[model samples]
Target: MKAATATILVLATFTLLSSGKKFRWCTLSDLEQRKCAELSKALLAVLPLATINSFARVSCIRAQNTHDCIDKIRVNKADAVSLDAGDVYSAVKLYGLTVVAKEIYEEGNCVFAVAIARRGTLDIQRLRGVRSCHNGARWTSGWNIPLGFLLARNELLWDEDQPLSQVISQYFNASCIPGVGITSPQLCALCQGPKSYVRNKNHFCETSSSEPFYDSEGAFRCLKNGVADVAFLDHLTIMNGTDSDQEEYELLCPDGSTAKLSAYGTCNLGRGPGRAIISRHNFQKITKKFLTLIQHLFGQNGKERAKFELFTSVPFRGKNLLFRDATQHLQLLKDKAEISHILGLDYVALLKGLGHEGSSLDNSVVRWCCISNAELRKCEEWALNIKSDPLVCVQAASMTNCIELIKSNEADAATLDATHAYIAGICGLVSVAAECYGEGCAPAAGRTKKLTHLADKALPPVYAVALAKKNARHVNIHNLRGRRSCHSHLYSPGGWLLLSRYTVGALENNTVNCDIGSAYQSYFWKGCMPGADKNLCKVCIGGGEMEGAKVSSRCAANHNERYYGNMGALRCLVGSPSGRSFGDVAFLEHHNLLKNIESLQSSGWAMGYTLNDFELLCLDGRRVAVTDWADCNLGPVPPNIVMTRPVTTTKIYGFLMKSQETLETNLDSKFHLFHSQKYGESDLLFKDATQYLVHTSHLDYQSILGDPFFQLAESVFNCTHADILEFCKQDICTS
Candidate 1:
């Protein structure tokens, strides 16, 4: 039986060697190479026991470091390599490599990165100038996870343009982070070099075992020896290396509290993925097959372990040489599993915060949110032509969704009308800039003329006018309770909320509990208030009678509805060529009322509409010329403001201000920052009559909206009664 086994082993080894199929494992140091060489021989010796066909012989490939190994694997120079979770993030993200298998320790396929400190020696909140120890420069538990936690929690202030090591050196008094090198010597101040080194005169911060404080065990040792106040390492390392009194050590959690070592699961910096075997994306299948075969042969219960152990580095006189010594088996990941799924979103976000994986932390590019396809097209054109700052366009289903997107960091900024701006502010957003009109910051005169700029002048507030057709003799503001009304949108400052407050609430005293939407639904006979679901949506012309129009988009609180904005409300009163006018009065801002009418004359829907065709319905129940809006208007309306998260207010304002200046001076430029007529839409992003953007970073929502408009907003959104505002507050609390 022994002779037959020997014959089969010889045949299998000869077949694998002669087939020229090889699995090259990348090694970072001489020690890892020697261990990999032993693993290769062991795999060859047990080849006959593996069930996989077309077996490949194992070979060791030497590389300078983990990043070099990743590059080699990317270009097909190496087949596979075992990497810590941090390097795995880099390998998969920067190189597009895929994980084939992960080393399963007693903690399963994940490990918790914890900060270990002697009892009463450290406080997580006051870590500045404290001596620290890390496993390695970019290792998972040591550098990335722990520092990333600090960065995320605002404990570390990184400019992202500089190296994170410089920030770390300035933060901690000294650290033993192996492989950080001479750029920051304080990082390697606590490292102990090899006791018996043959060469490499400078081994203080070497990545290999030559540096005594190079990994989890070394970091723990540094803390245990009273050299470092705190040691960042994995829970497994603390559990395995803690031979002294258990009560002497504790875990420094990110929440500024300390817990016993056994409570690491909840008190650690962050949970990280285990070490994984990575290969080229195309080589994943073969890599999985090869790993499965090898693990089955030399794993814990393998028949050939008596000859060569797979998970141990004691014989090689090193710790975690080729693979972690604590690994019990290899767990093959699903073929379709992505790197983000393996590392988890929280850890991935932490890495992103540190600028280690995925998109960099550069804030130069501003992502603008668009709520419609037409707006997206105009935004794309703006992104392409803007010269001062880079722009990227992100789309949302509605303006409220855009607000949520900006809050969640998925989007950066968006242009919102006064009402939506109020909602955005309630949801933790701030106004960064406000749209300014023509010369003297007044409304634009005409569409063809160039907009003039006056830097020192304050932007003029808009006027809310109740517009009506000159032919409608019986449609005065006082007798419009049973007549159809066209409003810009639901909860609009000028068209709906304030209009209701002054007209229905003041005149009739019928605004019960500040329910403006309910009041409007009961007052108006039938109309188009974009977000309303009652008779108000009955008159909305969704998609404007075009072919293949979506009926579901009717009364949508976005550009999808024909009567959705100031211009849209005007269109509702003007009517389409194929359809008659649907409303008796159109309430909207008077900023671009005449310009909108002139632009509508050129469209197929309202070919004959002109400035003289409409008149304003005054609050005194008198009808007057549309040009008398200053005296015959309902109230003053605030300008549309650009909203962004509070943290990104300055960045977003800078980008917008630069873009506004750049686009305003380039007369020969085809792309206009405020023009949306060429895109077959009006006011797609910013209002078409906007002259420039005024920086409002110093102003809050109330300041930007002005005292009168803000007071009206408070009355309209009384928290407990206003359903939209209540929902927004609930969302904020939950989120």
Candidate 2:
């Protein structure tokens, strides 16, 4: 059984390696690129050892640095690259790369930051004047790990008035830290520069092998050639670069004990994270196959272990590339989630401690808002339009999710109805803009001018009218019993709210229940009230014939609900299922009557209905024209308001306000920004009737909804129990 397992592993490796696919590996230097090409050929040759197989190809791409490699991968220009802990942090957070494989060493997957010195030349403590050699500044092993430990242990005193590099330089008599430039001269004070400070020269301070005293091997070379007393490097470098016969180098253990190079793991200054092979998050399937094949051929017990030395041997002499010199094997990583698992939290924190200045953190991009599946298409279009200038993006879910998104900093702004706006205010989100109807009741020149044409301002309330077939004389205000009805969602002001007030207040002698939803459900035989409990969806045929989950799903509050918003309710009124479940009346906004008449042919549900087919039910007990809503409408409600988090900066506000200007000034014929029909037949992220977005910066929730209207909406929202006067107040503000 075990033999079969081993054979299967080997055969799988050979088969995948011979697939003839090109795997591009990113490298920093030409030498490394050449080495990667050689390694690729060697890896391909291993498949033939067991039997003939396909030849897998490897291509090397050159990048300026570790960060540049991540950028290349993000745009799909390159496939994969190896990165240190700091670079891995940037890759995951900024470019969304997945860590596919980890480079394992002899002792374990990780190597430690170790300090090496000639015997008796350096002490664990009280050696402030000793000279030092480092691989480079900003490196995990050479700088952050060791220096951070010393500062934490109080062995090194930090001077607040001076740069950290200056303090470190003052502590050592002379030091050679490659990559430290003239910005901090103290850091470059002891660097012995070559004639031109170029490659293939001695004593040039650079991160690459071009400098004699660069990288881990170069730092140790500074000590070997008697230029510096002590060198800071990883255990792998000290062991790989030193001779077996040489007794000059010793590791400085944290316990103040000197040990042989073999004992460096326990005697190290601090443990450092290993390098990771990263690819785009979406390329996991292919990357996994590639990683598995490489591990099988070059692993500790592979057929070509000696001849190719894919993992154990250095492919190039001058530089590190493709894989590090001492890496024993490549171990597969489960996901990007393993980044924090492989690199301990302390080490990860050490990398993030660099702060957000000039790092991968981008604060300039503006995050737009979205809620539910209905708005996804429109939000994505908006995101694409402002992709460059003051870049905008959208991410939010349902109305409830949008409130949470604002609180969690995931989204910046959303446009909502009066009821939803009030809920957002209670949740601590404030209204930033109000929807202007452009009815010409107020002038359009000033920013803070009073909106005269807007309804539900504590003046005359926006009307909510009931619609029924013109010939349905049997249904009336007093005898509306056991009739199929349609509503614009459960919480909508025009639908559920107005009807609740009528049933619980005006018909007090007949209405018994105080729970408005329960009362409505019992009053109507069966109805389509999206966002209602399951019992309310009993009669929904889901476009008159579909059954089971389809009908059930069509009863939700979001776009999935077939009979959800204003247009959906109108569709329900005109919709009939071959003499089966058709709504007798529809409770919706008065203006929707006109929209329904115009869309009779394009909208499938209103197929047989005409402009004169529907009539409005008046409180005066008369059926009137759909245009006679002014006298028959229930009451006025507030318009939708755009809301956002209470941000201290004007960045988000400026983005939305600018978008408002572009949308209003240049309304595209195919795509109206404010009344966006791009997503569906109904209004999407913003209301369809919206003429423009008006800035209401200084207005609070009370001011936006008007004081009288705020009180009315609050009473309806707080109505939890049964009492004719308590459930339905007569003074429910007319507006």
Kindly provide the TM-score of model 2 when superposed on the true structure, using C-alpha atoms.
0.46
Please give the lDDT score at residue 281 for candidate 1: 78
> Which number leads on TM-score?
1
lDDT of 1: 0.76
Worst 10 residues of 2 by lDDT: 726-735
Residue 493 CA displacement from its true place in model 2, Å? 0.9
Residue-wise C-alpha lDDT for candidate 2, range 469-504, written one tens digit per residue: 898987766566678888877667778766766655
Error of 1 at 521 (Å): 21
| Candidate 1 per-residue lDDT over residues 1-735, each given as its tens digit | 965764555455445444567778898677888988887776656554542343335678887556678889999899998888888888887778898888888867777899889998887888999999998777778987777667544467665557878999999999999877678888988888753354335456766665777788888889888999999988877666444636799988765789988888899986677788999878787777666655656778766788777888888888788888888888878887866667654455446545675345345478899988889998998887767657889998778788877765678889998878988888657777788765665435653333232244456777889999999998897888878889988777788766875556823333353466667777888999887877888898787776444787788888887778888898888775567747889999887888788888677767877888899998898889988998999887788888876545545766776676677667888998888888876888898878667767656777777777776677666632544455445310010
Residue pairs whose backbone atoms clash in candidate 2: 18-54, 372-397, 461-636, 461-735, 462-636, 462-637
